[model samples]
Target: MFRQLKKAATFAAAVLATTTLVSTAQAADYPEKAITLVVPYGAGGASDLAGRALAETARNYTNEQPVVVVNKTGNGGMNGARYVTEQKPDGYTLLLSRVGMALYPAVYTDSPVAWDDYTFLGILESTPMILAVNANSDIKTVDELLAKIKSSNGATTYAASGPTAIDGFTVQALLADADLDPLSASTLVPYKGGSALAAALLGGHVDFLAIAAGSLMPHIEAGKMRALMVYAPKRMDALPDVPTAKELGYNLAGQVDGWSALFAPKDLPEDVVAKWKDILSNVATNDQWLDLAKKRGSVSVVGDQDPAAFVKSQYELYNGMAKKFGYIQ
Candidate 1:
């Protein structure tokens, strides 16, 4: 009986050793195929553009496998976000998500995806929200837009992808700053996605739009839309003519910035997380990435701070802003 017990113990030890070795080898051999980045919104939107740009520049640091972006739009970004949580946590499938993920709790009382359900890699880039109107519209300046909102008295309209979206939140905050009744001073038109919002704006369904600056660069350059003011500390190089809210003497605060980050399924291997952080850290400093972001009218923000902390702060910030604007309890 003693001999049998000793033999069993030996077998158990061997199995444990072999398991550790296999895990180590797997970590070393990770990312053998293409990495898929799931953007929760449709193509041509700000998130899609930033995800594509990051994937394109990630090849410079990736181990030869290309990073592909897939758009699974719906449910105000919850659909695509939840889809990634169901995928394998092998660092192969990642979510290039937005501020909406952090704002979910404040916006949705029963959210399907928790902020802690994913491992946040880091914030990749951010673009200030742009307040724009169709080029042919008589309202061309921020003051004019405000006057229209005040004079129209719940008649003048603005389009946003959704009530919980960053753009929508910006519109709400803008009204709050101007001391205008959000519900009465203007009608907030909601759409399913940025593409739809763009259509509504261009087709004259809404008087104006508040969206990521990068998303409207093409339209503005094509003479289809006119940018009034950006919600940033200063004007962007790409859109140098557009003044900031501060420059225009309107303080919309820091809550209007739009950002995108990378996330993986929860319980990702430590080594895999570290690998991604390193890869993305490199991508943040890459000149090509910066130039691409500039061309897209976005700015690259790669801070050395822990990503988890950054995400937490953003969640808190958005939650506070939502409560202030009466978006949630």
Candidate 2:
């Protein structure tokens, strides 16, 4: 009787020990500390503004400490992305990346990294890019500008946000199709952000800039600039008179739209990633979030927050564009 009782007690204790271990290993209430939201662009840029707004809203979704917004601008978000990838995958460090994140791999052959390195939460918003110039500039339309640049015989320059940025290739591709020879007749000046480019344009430092539609709307309202054209397949209702690049004899259509999304390191605990996915999925549908997105001209969308699907989609879209532009095989 004593031996049998001892065996029973010993087995019960061992079972309890194993259960405790497994239970403890499971995900607990996550985000125990402050979360860092890294923006891959400079401050006051469109991406930074959108990212901060999202971070603020995300804070309300949890009772943990407020999220911190960090600008890690370098190599057009590659540095920031690599930084996040190198961090411990506990969901403490998150990347709020724009379309440039995907464009990087597309533009650079044998890129040092790939999108699969990090877990994409979901796309926050996406919008189309546009062509804008100072209101007082002699060039009033896309046709006029093209004629001027081709006729001037003097080099013209354009301001860009970054190399891997959507503006980089989209604008370059536009010039490429025009047979205008961007490098031969135009200088491409890459600034850190749109606001800076706007400043430069206002100060007569740059000839013009190709920015997303939303970023230039405020200035257009102020009468400081006028949109030459909106880079969409169809004319945007906001400015119907302006023709798309395609309508004006350019094959480009809706190629300039960009997006921002959240990502965590791939090593994140599945439960932690799940918790964020759940919270953000609901957050993606919030009225306040939608309103904010509208204000920025970003379309709030219900998308695949699954990292695998997200990365795959990015790979396909960007990779295809790269191949079409002859930037990749």
Candidate 3:
């Protein structure tokens, strides 16, 4: 009986040692092959652009492995999230983690994964949503827009690609803050992606659109749209003249800061996580990456706080916001 117990203990120790050794070896050769950054949104959207930008500059601070951007659209970002979470936890496949990860689970009845299911790597950048109207429209300020909505009697239209997406809730929260019913004041039109929403706004299909400033910058610069209010803690340098929601007596902007992070599947090796945390920290400061971020109007969240803590805090913050906004029961 003693010999049998001793044999079992020794076998267990050997298995543990072997597993640790394999994980260490895998970490040493991490990214020996190309890495794929999966973006849940379709092409030309803000998330897609950020994913492509990160892929382009990943080698600047990490291994020379080619980082490819792949867009897997549908199911309110669940499809792409599932693809990465179900992939090997070797840090090869990554999700361009979006606010939806924290939000969908709170609001959507069919969320496939929760926040804790992801290996929180680090956040790279974040930006606040902006409310804008077509350049040709007479609405020029937040008050005017609110008045228009209050009087439109559901005649005014707004476009949000997905009902549960950041834009959708943002527009809802904005209207609600202004003492108007988001549902009764105007009709919320759904589009496929940012590109479609932009087209609709530009072609007079919608009265105004709420979206990330980065996605609307090119159009605004082209004189196709004009920003009215920014949902940020303060004014953005990119749109210095635009007032924040707080300035307009609406305090919802600070709650709407959307962020994007680099995340792997759960149980990723610690060494790999450290490697990516270091790489992303450096990438956030790299001149090329910073220049791209400025052009896109995204603020770098790297080095601002602990990555794991930031992810957890943001999840909680969005969860509370989801409840406050009545997205969840």
The estimated TM-scores of all candidates read 0.89, 0.80, 0.90
Candidate 3 is scored at a TM of 0.90
Let me know the TM-score candidate 2 reaches against the reference structure.
0.80
Q: List ranges where model 3 is wrong by over 4 Å.
A: 1-15, 308-329
Judging by lDDT, tell me the better candidate of 2 and 3: 3
State the lDDT at 116 in candidate 2: 73
**Candidate 1 ranges beyond 4 A from true positions:** 1-10, 138-140, 246-253
lDDT string, candidate 2, 238-309, tens digits: 676777777777654345556778888887777787778777887787887777777766666546455456
Ranking by TM-score: 3, 1, 2
Model 2 stretches with alpha carbons more than 4 Å out: 1-28, 109-112, 162-164, 232-253, 302-329
Give every collision pair in model 2. none
lDDT of each candidate versus the true structure: 0.82, 0.74, 0.82
Clashing pairs in 3: none
Candidate 1 lDDT at 272 equals 88
